[model samples]
Target: MTKAWAEEILDWNYEPPYDFYNDNNKEESMKELLEAPYFAVLNDSGNLAGFYCIGYAAQVPLGYLFGAYQEDCVDIGLGMKPELTGKGNGGSFIRFVLEQVKGSKSIRLTVADFNERAITLYERAGFKKTYMFAGEEMSFFVMEKRSL
Candidate 1:
């Protein structure tokens, strides 16, 4: 169910060093959008703190979800208001994503190697390194968390 505080979290720009699903790839973007299930956080006053999008549930990532493994695992993307970063909000947000992703083989995601802060948060959120992929343009860490 969409929570009362969810609206505040609903508005966000997930663009960054990784730019997880943005306007750049318009052709395939809408397809991914359809697959996302949103989760929101509430403040003490019951206002929304932030939100994230988890893809690959009954929801599909356009067609991206199909090629990347055939099980029930989800690919996660999240953001807090830029002003709310580094004070542990991100860690909690990631934990929230993990909670939503609970069950199945595992959750998978790619992180730019240079984004050490995010990498640390992922590690704290129980993500483990699965592989490293690099190209002339960038390098990333392929991380996964096995389901209990």
Candidate 2:
């Protein structure tokens, strides 16, 4: 992602309806986004739609979910622009991202329990809840999608 797009993404905020990631501390958020190895998700016109990181869950504290860093599976972290969410395009967008990943028989992602919309999107894309993990601030479901 370009520095400009990364800055824009770090500034994206959610309203009360989507408060799952509601953090008032922008500095920490920006740092985390910038430090993560993520790729820009661009729209058809090539504008940044969002950003995602492949296999990040295995490296973060969330590694507990994989029983000390399993390498046989792929785990993803995704963030869509706050404005683009709930506009009826998430399912297709996720599918397209999945298509871009290479050489993995299965993919996994973790989502906060409060993110019903994201859970629904993952479910529709054939992801099933494998287990749940409790983080310091919230609980999450580790969902998995196996290639058919």
Segments in model 2 whose C-alpha atoms lie over 4 Å from true places: 22-35, 57-71
| Best candidate according to lDDT | 2
lDDT of 2: 0.76
lDDT of 1 by residue, 89-145 (tens): 786677766776677667877667787888898888889877665666656676777
Weakest ten-residue segment in model 1 by summed lDDT: 57-66
Clashes of each: 1, 0
TM-score of each: 0.62, 0.83
lDDT of 2 by residue, 1-148 (tens): 6678778876778986576665567777666667766778999998889888887622346647556335367878888888899999898789878887745478888788789999999999889987777768777787888866
Candidates' C-alpha lDDT? 0.60, 0.76
Q: How far is candidate 1 from the true structure (C-alpha RMSD, Å)?
A: 5.1
